[model samples]
Target: MKPKKKSLSDLGGIMYSTDPSFVYEEENEIPEQALPNQQQDLRVMLDKKNRGGKAVTLVTGFRGSDEALEKLGKMLKTKCGVGGAAKDGEVMIQGDFRDKVVDLLQKEGFKVKKSGG
Candidate 1:
């Protein structure tokens, strides 16, 4: 499926260049490689600001691919038996499981730090 264009800039600025020699170079972005578990620095914290006062354990500072992040999120959710989301390089596990999350991440070989209140 084609993605919806949000603005004129999304369509590329130079739509029709009169010069025959003009060549439009498309931007190619390379996805970052996932770091090894031992090399990863992760932070686990408790957040309750935006969720109607219900706390969530937030895991951040993950320098890896989205798939890896999702996998880690799934593992945490399964172990904690809670529902959450993994996106934008962050994992949100329902409830304040900061201590458990830290232990799990540490077991996975990630250098984890407990931050925030």
Candidate 2:
């Protein structure tokens, strides 16, 4: 069997800079906030692979803060009467609720569309 690939985080402090004068100092620049993708069209897809044949409604194209994502996720879960999580700029609701989710997103002034077969 092939060995699994190591992610960047897996390296864990093993990185080294080759430059002799490379002074590693954390930047003091202010971080820019993520703007919500309210005007962007979002895609709602039903994914089953790698999930033991169970379906999940994946709402993608979200660009905003984690708080916003969680808020939206909570609202969707409540509306659908199901459980789910929001992370990495995506909202995942348990079960296949593509149509319902799309409708709800549209009603919330989001440009959402049901995607995938």
Candidate 3:
């Protein structure tokens, strides 16, 4: 099977007549002083979900990309010698690693706060 050919205007004319660099220029114009502090900006939560009769700990409230979360997750897992995954901006460790995670984030200069039971 093959897809049909369409012009730049086919997608609601978003791609056509729009200078791609326009957005980039606007984004790059923001000064560093305008950016929020990392310590006060991020939120950490522990969510428990019942999957297949097993409880899973979901650590969320990160304000970065998948790459950042993945890197942090890898480091945390390696440091703790455990298993986990970084998905959708959340880090899921196989066990209760809240304290360990907080410590690691603190060491990395992140302002972290534990929320929820």
lDDT by residue (1-117, candidate 3, tens digit) is: 112237754444455346646542112232223222264344555555664544344566565545666887798789878887887657777766678778777778778777778
User: Where is model 1 more than 4 Å wrong at Cα?
Assistant: 1-26
Best-performing candidate as measured by lDDT: 1
The TM-score between candidate 2 and the true structure equals 0.72
lDDT of 2 by residue, 1-117 (tens): 112337855444547889998776643645436554567568999999899999999998776667788998999999999999998768999999999999999888888888888
The residue ranges of model 3 lying beyond 4 angstroms of the native Cα positions read 1-40, 52-57
lDDT by residue for model 1 (1-115), tens: 1234588697688678889999988656466777899988898989999899999999988877778888999999999999999988899999989999999889989999999
How many clashes show up per model?
0, 0, 0
What residue pairs are clashing in model 2? none
Best by TM-score: 1
Lowest summed lDDT over 10 consecutive residues: which window, candidate 1? Answer: 1-10
